[model samples]
Each structure stands twice: as C-alpha cells, then as structure tokens.
Target: SRSKNSNKERNLIRAFTVLDAYASKLSMPENAKEHAAYIYRKAVSKDIIRGSSIPSMMAASVFAACKQLGIPRSMNDTAKVANMSKKKLSRTYKRLVKNLELNVSSFEADYVSKISNSLSVSEKTARLAGKIIHDLKKEHLHVGKNPIGITAASLYLSAINYDEHVSIEKISKKTNISTVTIRKMIKLLRPFASKYLKSIDLSV
Candidate 1:
C-alpha cells in the first residue's frame, strides 16, 4: 500500500510539472491553471489518465480548461507549447472531453482580443474585429467554424477598413492558423464586410 501510494504521488507531481510548463508557456491565467489542475485531478480519480502520457494528458487538460473558461488559446498554440503534434493533442483533448463530460464551447469573439493583441492592432481595429465577430454570431455564421480562423479573418478585415496594413501572412503567423483557412474565412466574411463597415462608420 505504501509503495502504491508513493507511485500515485509521483505520477501526480510529474503530471503537474508538465501542466505548469505548458501553462506558463501559454501564459495561462492563475484561475485557468487552477481549473486545469482540478480537471487533471478529476481525470486521475476517474482513471482516465491511465495509459495516456503525462504531457498529452496535461496538454489536453489545459486546453479543455481554456475552452471551458473561454480563453482564446488555440489547439495549435497549446500543441506547440506542449511539444506535441496537433493531431495527438486534439485526439487527447477529445478523449478528455468525452471522459470528463466537459461542456467545452468557445467563440470567435472570445479570440478577438488575443489575436488583436498579438498582432498589435489599434484599439479601434480590435473593437471593429469584435463587432464583426458579434454581428456574424447573431446570424449563427460562426457556428461549426474554426474560432481562430474566423477571429483572424475578422481582424484582417478590420485592419483593411482602418487602413492598418496588417497582412494575412502576419495574422497566420501570429495565430498559427493557415493562410488558406484565414482566406476561406475572409471569403465568408466579405459579403458581410460592407454591412459591418457601414455599422462601424455610422457609430463613429
């Protein structure tokens, strides 16, 4: 019993170490980190951690926490920080979500601030991007879409309207979303662009 307890303790310490490393790299807030730790503990209690590598489990836990808390970190960002493949991280994340019965939903608007901050867009541009996201959301356009791609596309459109000169490649690099994905999202947003712009202009 003593040996078994020690092994469990060691595994927990190892898991938490991995969690802290990636969480720090991603600059997760303390509350998010705590939430992730709680999730990890729950996973252990449920034996969902069995046979999964510590890094993958920790990465999935933090990713789950971010989604639950509506943080803007993408799976690509978390995978890179965890030094794991996006495919593997995604697989692990899905497993954790299923096993934990977690209700994980995030929106494009939730990501506007993070992507805009990373790209250093002006406050006006950020607000415009946010408005673009929300306006589209009202129509349920963002449903079944990649949040990062949609958020990036909105920011790109906002920058153009504001004559801010941020490029698609720059947004792609900052967001770890593909230029192709961003372009596809842009195409979807184009028809609505004039309307969004008109609203912004009217407000200004």
Candidate 2:
C-alpha cells in the first residue's frame, strides 16, 4: 500500500503543477490548487484512474475542480495545459463527473479580477470590465457562455477604452481562450458596451 500512496502523492503533485501552469494567476490560486488535489484523491479512491490516461485524469479533475470551486479556468484552458483537445477535455471531464459524482455547481465565474491580475491592468480597468460583465449578466446575455471568453472580451474593451492598448491575441494567450470566441463576445456586447463605458467615462 506504500507504493500506492506514493503514486497518489506523485500524481497529486503532478496535477497541481499542471494546473498551476494555466491557473497561476487565479484570484484564489491556492483554493483551486488544493481542490484539484482533492478531486484527484477522490477519483483515485473510486479507482476511476484505472486503465485511463494519467494526464487526462488530472486534467479532467482540474477542470471539474475549477467548476466545482466556481473558478475561471475553462475546459479549453485545461486542455491547453494538458496538451489535449477541447473535445477530449470535455469527454474526460464528463467522465470524471460521472464516475466521481462530483457536486458540480452552477457556473458563477469570478473572472474579472483574475483576468485583471493576469493582464496587470489597473484596478479601475478591472472594475470597468467587471461592470461590463455585470451588465451582461443583468441583461441575461452572459448565460450559457464561457466566462474566460467573456472576461477576455470585457478586459479588451476596458483596455482600449482606457488606453491600455492590450490586444486580442495577448488576452487569448493569457486566458487560454480562443481569439474567435473573444471577438464574438466583443461584437455581442458592442450595442450595450457604450452604456457601461459611458458610465465609467470611457468610449467604445
């Protein structure tokens, strides 16, 4: 049993390392990291890791942990860290949820702060971007959408309006979200963007 324990420890360390690569800038980095390790342990207890890919298991657990923790690492971000595709990440994440019966809760991503730190933007920018997200949520336009994309788009809008000069590509790489998705959200918010910006004395 010593051998098994050792392996679990090793796997947990590996999983944490992998998650840190992508989620290093999360507002509650330690919480997400510890929760991921907890998910790995629970999965191991269920013997769900049997005959499965280790990286995939760790990746899926991390993704579920993010969702369970209400953090902002998207499946795409997890896939990028694990070097897997979005489809595969989704598949393994679903399997992890099914096998472990994890209590995955509703998506309430606290991403503006995380993205703000990642971008090294000022607090004012983060607040304005957060206001954009809040506006979208109030309008019922942000439902069923990936938070990373929306956060990136919001940050982009905030940056440009505030003369921060951050680019779409930079946001994409930092958040591990696709540029296309960010742009789509940007376009969707264009009509309503002005109101939020105007309140903050910003122009889109």
Candidate 3:
C-alpha cells in the first residue's frame, strides 16, 4: 500500500512551486527578489500549512516581504488571506525581520507598492502612506521604535482621515500592536493630518 501525504505537506509543495515561479518573474530591487525567495522557503518549511492554499502562502510570503523590507501590510488583512493564526504568523514574521536585518530608516517606494498590492489596496493609498512616512521622518519623530508598528500606524491614520473607514482593531490585528498604540499614533498626527490630507488631495 502507498503512504498518503498530509494536506499541509501538499500545500507546502504547491507553495514552493508557486513561489519558484514568482521568483522567476519578479523584476525589482535585488533585495526584493531575495526577500521574496526567503518568504517562499519559509512557507514551504512550515508544518501546518497545505499545498492547496497557495494564496495563503502567498499572503504570508508577502507579509514577510513587507516586514523584511520595512513596508507595512495590515496583519489582520494579510492573515485573513493567508488563513493563519495571528500569533503564529507574528512569530514567523519577526524571525524573518531579524534575519533580514532590514533598514527602517530608508523608505523603499517599490517595496511599499508591493505591500499595497499584497493587501489589495490602491496605489494611491500606498503612495499616501509612503508620503506620510517620508514626512514623518522630516519631523525627526521617534517612529522607528518599531518599523512595522509605525508603518501600520501611518497607514491607519491616512485611512481614517481620508474617510477610508478602517478600524483601529483591524489595523491592530495586522501590526500586532495594541489599540492604545494605534490611538496614540493617531493623536500625535492630529496636527499634521490636515496638512497631509490637503496635500494628498491636491496631488490627486
């Protein structure tokens, strides 16, 4: 009799195939490709995930990519697509972030765009978040305590001010930050939000 493989094993194998394909087609910064490949490998090695769930793998890989490159994608949204537990994904995500030794000081516009695509948000929204991030840097704000944390905060601020209606709970779930931190970041940005919103509006 032949032995049967588990669904998780099958998923890992399928994820590896898809990631290998993505690696072949990807055209971007050298680091992006490397990070993408790293994420693919990580997902393939996970014991609980399945081969039929390539999209979930893709989501996890993309989330890893975002962290590795210092771009932010909401954890709740990403996990929803990936079908993984927040705690499990967060641990994996942090490990990747540490291994990659990513730079949070320098903003990567391309990586931000990729994250936006992964989250299925508009380029404009991504660009807005990127711009706000850039502006925040100018203020010499100590937002770098946690790159992903700040990035999520910035995006959430942008979303709320623009009437995008993304809840703090949702953003908190994705970034693994508390709702209090999210609220604090929003409060800190209140003075600048109006100006940033106006600028974004004019640019559009």
Candidate 4:
C-alpha cells in the first residue's frame, strides 16, 4: 500500500523550502545557520508561519534572530530591508505571538511603533496606544475573545482618540480590518473616546 501524505507533511516540506530561501537571501553567517534552524524549527512547531506568508514570517524571524545575535537592526530599517508593509507585518507578528502563545510584550511595542512610524506619528503616540490596549486587556475587554479583532478595534480607537489625523478609511486600509467594524468600534468607544483623548499628549 502507498503511504498517504498529510497536510502536516506538505506544510513541513514547504516550511523547509521557505527556510532555505530565507537563509540564502540573508547570506547569514556560518554559525548563524544553527540559530536560523532553531528559530525555523520553533516557528514550524508553533504552526503560525504558513508558506504563503513565509516572507512575513521570515521578516519577523530575522528580527528575532538579530535580537538574539545582538545584531541591532531598527524596526523601520528591518521593514524596509524586508520590503514588507509595516502594518501588515505588524498584524502578522501579532498572529505569530498568538500562535506561539508567547508571553513576551516587547514585540507588541514593536508592532505599535511600526504602525506609528508608518503613519508618521511620534513614538509617544504609539506608546500611548499600547498603554490604552494594555489597560483594556486588564479590564477584561479581551476576556474569552478573539484577540486580533479586539486589538484591531483597540488600535483604531486609540488612533482616533489620540487625534492622529489618520482617517478611519486609512486605518481600515492599513490594518486590513473592515471599515464597518472600524466605524462600529469607533461608535462603541465614542463616550469614552473624549475622556481618553484628554489624557494623552498629541504633539507630533
């Protein structure tokens, strides 16, 4: 009898192919191959880095690799070098965290900063949005829920509350969330939006 190939087997083969391409592109140091393999293995084990989005995963993985190796590339620089959209990559990074169940919050900061940097806002604005999202999480807004939906909602609300001048359409376009959902989230936050706005510094 012939053996059957499962989805997992196909995914594994694709994963290896992606890793090979990534390693070739980076021309990573000889010793770095081991580190790359380690990270790739972890990503595969986690099952979040799909072959279709391997480039995005590779971008995040390279950032992770750089941090581990103390290579020090700025988020903006990495996004540029990777030629990936910062906002889309940020969303992918969040998906990676959810899939890996990682407790690390620093990557969240990078996500927010990437959005701010992309929107040409100050880092402070991003930090403020991060704070709002953190506070919301503590209040159980994210309880028993879809985190990506909650996060996209929270970020949209935060951008408006901070008076960032980025229209809802633009946020929808950037975050890839539906405009209807954005409007709904905005309306839901309306009563509290003004209150939140009063507390954050809007310079920049």
Whose TM-score is greatest here?
Answer: 1
Clashes of 1: 0
**Residue-by-residue lDDT tens digits, candidate 2, 1-204:** 999989978876776676566556443367777888788878878888887677788788777877765556666667877788999878878888988888786433456776778889888888888777788889899877887788788888878777888888898877767788888988877666777564443332
What lDDT does the true structure give each of the candidates?
0.84, 0.75, 0.57, 0.57
* Model 1 vs. true fold: TM: 0.59
Which residue pairs clash within candidate 4? none
TM-score of 2: 0.56
Prediction RMSDs, each to the true structure = 7.4, 7.3, 11.9, 13.1
TM-score of 3: 0.43
Residue range 28-114, candidate 3, lDDT tens digits: 244654676566655455432343246554655666665556544456656654567776667655554455443433343644554
Rank the candidate models, highest TM-score first.
Answer: 1, 2, 3, 4
lDDT of 3: 0.57
Residue 63 lDDT, candidate 4, scale 0-100: 56
Best model number under lDDT: 1
Q: Encode model 1's per-residue lDDT on 32-69: one tens digit a residue.
A: 99999999999888889888898999899999997876
Compute the lDDT of residue 42 as modeled in candidate 3. Answer: 56
User: Positional deviation of 54 in candidate 1, in angstroms?
Assistant: 0.7
The residue ranges of model 2 lying beyond 4 angstroms of the native Cα positions read 1-38, 42-62, 65-109, 198-204
Per model, state how many residue pairs clash: 0, 0, 5, 0
In model 3, pairs of residues that clash are 10-51, 11-50, 11-51, 75-174, 76-174
